[model samples]
Target: MTKLIHVAAAAIFNPEGQVLLALRSKQQHQGGLWEFPGGKVEANESVLEALSRELDEELDIQIDHAATRPLIQVPYHYPDKSVLLDVYKVSGFSGVPHGAEGQPLEWVDIANLEQYDFPAANTPIVNALLLPQCIAITGNANGTAEYVKKSVAAISGGAQWLMLRAHQLSSSERTALARQIRATIDAADGVVLSLNGSVAEANDCGVNALHLSSDKLMVLNTRTEFRGRWLSASCHTIEQLEKAVSLGLDFVTLSPVKTTATHPEQPAMGWQAFSELVNAYPLPVYALGGMTAEDVDQSCQSGGQGICAIREYW
Candidate 1:
């Protein structure tokens, strides 16, 4: 068996939402490609310590450790080696970032990251970067007009990602509502709309993504044909999370982080349990159920991509 090598990487972002990418030297592993600034974790240092040390060594900046948020962990295998990448988002830092190691560096816009070549392990990191920290879901609106109004408000309030989820609507009604919401989202310029239904429904509605219910998640053994569309699942247990990962879904929302009105009887996972589950998995997981935008920082610290709220967010 090949031993696992641990690497700590940082996605250092600027105020413009552009993340810093380092052009690996031609002689280095995965060289001549743009990658996040980081290095191998030393035996004696924690992942956080290694991350802070590496950023200072490679970029000549001191990261505010308190402000660092755990982003994603990616495990990839090359022909000769296996590596576990521990990545974090560095938001606060002292000193300007420069290529202190004599390697080329550039701040690339999050949306255009795919234009450059990156290591296979970094693909998920790039996807996570493109996703918003808070995903607003249109919850239990009384009518199509009400749903559209709330969705527009959410988008206008700076929510770049949204899930239109009026499960009570009939098939025809749902389709019509989806079209109206999609038009509104497009008018907002580049907002991503995810429909809470099956692949066929999402495709028919012409949405950007699909959100699978937990029951849908359990029945699927393989990824669906939603080419060019993001796929997300609602996960409750580790088993559900593992299933979603096996199906290669883009992200999952681990729910009931706190007791929600919809499921008051369901037990809450709490922050500690939620952290444990996410840390054990590599894919980005969002804290769902009774979450608000104000809980984003806490969610990040708990190893979540962010909060996926239905009630509070809307």
Candidate 2:
């Protein structure tokens, strides 16, 4: 078995919403790339302790314990070493951060972070940071026109990300609905639209992102058609979440955080259990099934990205 190195990392942000990044020196492993600043966790240290200590030592900053939250934990393996990166979001901190240890530091805009080269392990961090907090999924509509209208309304009601799941519609109807949604999304700034269907349908609709149902998520071997685009899945268990992580998916929606009319047969995983399952594979997860706009804060506190809903979000 490969020895696992436990590291605590921080996605420290400034008041302007820009994140702090540090450049690795030429002598370091994965050198010449930018990375979130952090250090290895000592045997006796807690993750928060390590994070606070490292930030204070390396950047001369003090983290506000109340404002710190769990971000994502990444388990990455190199040819010779394996590491588990326990990441946190440091939104509240006091200090003008600088390169206290002679490392060059940069404050980068979140959207522009992609211009810089990052280690493979840092890829998921970028993706998570780029994602929106809430996603509105279109429920079953009477027709294609109604679907488009409802989706546009959801966007109008402060939902920047939308998942169009009109599976009841035929291919041509679905394409038309998607095109209308795309047109409205294109008009707005930073709006993202994804299709909840097959790759062929997504391609035909001219959208770049595809969301997979649980069954489809289990059967995929590779993201052959979705290499450059965002691919997400709906997962319910650790196994399904593990499959998503292994397949290099962008994000996932874990369902039944509470009892819902849609899937009453499936028992609700209360906030505590949901947190436990999420901690096992801490991808950017949106709480689905019985989720509403009101549950966003609780979801975030329970280690979720946000809420994915059909009714309440719309």
Candidate 3:
């Protein structure tokens, strides 16, 4: 049996939501086809450790604190070799992305990853990236923490990832609340603590990443200072999605997978429609727009990393 090459890669996105695709040398097997920058995993290193090392050696870039965003774990197979590709979003790097392996490079939008011919093994990865997601902050009502009593209750029930979309709180008040949630979430690796609209608050609160509205997403493009954080955004259309991509957002909420009870007045893009829209998307997408944890498995089956739901949380 051929030994599987442990591999890692960086889907480095530019300010336009375009990903950096390295073109292979004419001598390579997948010559002329484009790919994310990375290389084979080495011995005894964690996948992330290997990713960091490989990116530096392969692209001559440093994986700084903010750009180190996890995208997905992919499994691919070739005639002679099998590979497990641990991919990440290089959101913040010190230098221009280059191909240290002597391959040419191009930065393509995430939606275009499939357009360029990559190895067959990378197909699933391409899909994982295109799916949209929505992370709901259960227990909070209409962007205000009534008491945080409901928020506490919801987490106990099942909501693993919670965002404090508390719009009404004063900065000091919200920061305190986020810090409290962070303390609670620290124990649950599966649970993430995210904050709405404030990178400074998130970093100070010690949460996971930032969730930006399309408005906010647009404002932050080309700004690499992360406050040492994970970043996400909200997208309604392909255009906004590109902005998120360019900014190197860690994740995002692309909503209304189903006709949402909360937003019934708003039109919905059914599952088929959502899948079609997301076809060939290049980043990890969580099926948002009215989905639940129960729907997560189905979302992955359809074309997403999983489903992110506000209603089903806890």
The most accurate candidate by TM-score is: 2
Q: Each candidate: what lDDT?
A: 0.86, 0.86, 0.67
Q: Candidate 1: lDDT of 19?
A: 88
**Which candidate number has the best lDDT?**
2
Greater TM-score among 1 and 3 belongs to 1
Error of 3 at 210 (Å): 1.2
Candidate 2 deviant stretches above 4 angstroms: 1-3
TM-score of each: 0.90, 0.93, 0.56
Q: State residue 128's C-alpha deviation in candidate 2, in Å.
A: 1.1
lDDT of 2 by residue, 52-82 (tens): 9999999999999998998777778889788
lDDT of 2 at 291: 85
The regions of model 1 sitting more than 4 angstroms off are 1-3, 77-79, 94-96, 221-224
Shift in Å, residue 290, candidate 2: 0.7
Residue 299 lDDT, candidate 1, scale 0-100: 85
TM-score: model 3 vs. ground truth: 0.56
Model 3 global lDDT (CA atoms, 0 to 1): 0.67
Candidate 3's residue-wise lDDT over 1-314, tens digit each? 66667778877877778778787776776666667778877778886788778778878877775656666665545676677777776677787777787767787877666678886556545655553343557445533344355566656776656777767778788888777666655776456677786666666766656676678777774535456445777777888877765565555566677788768987877777666555434455677766766786566545456666666754
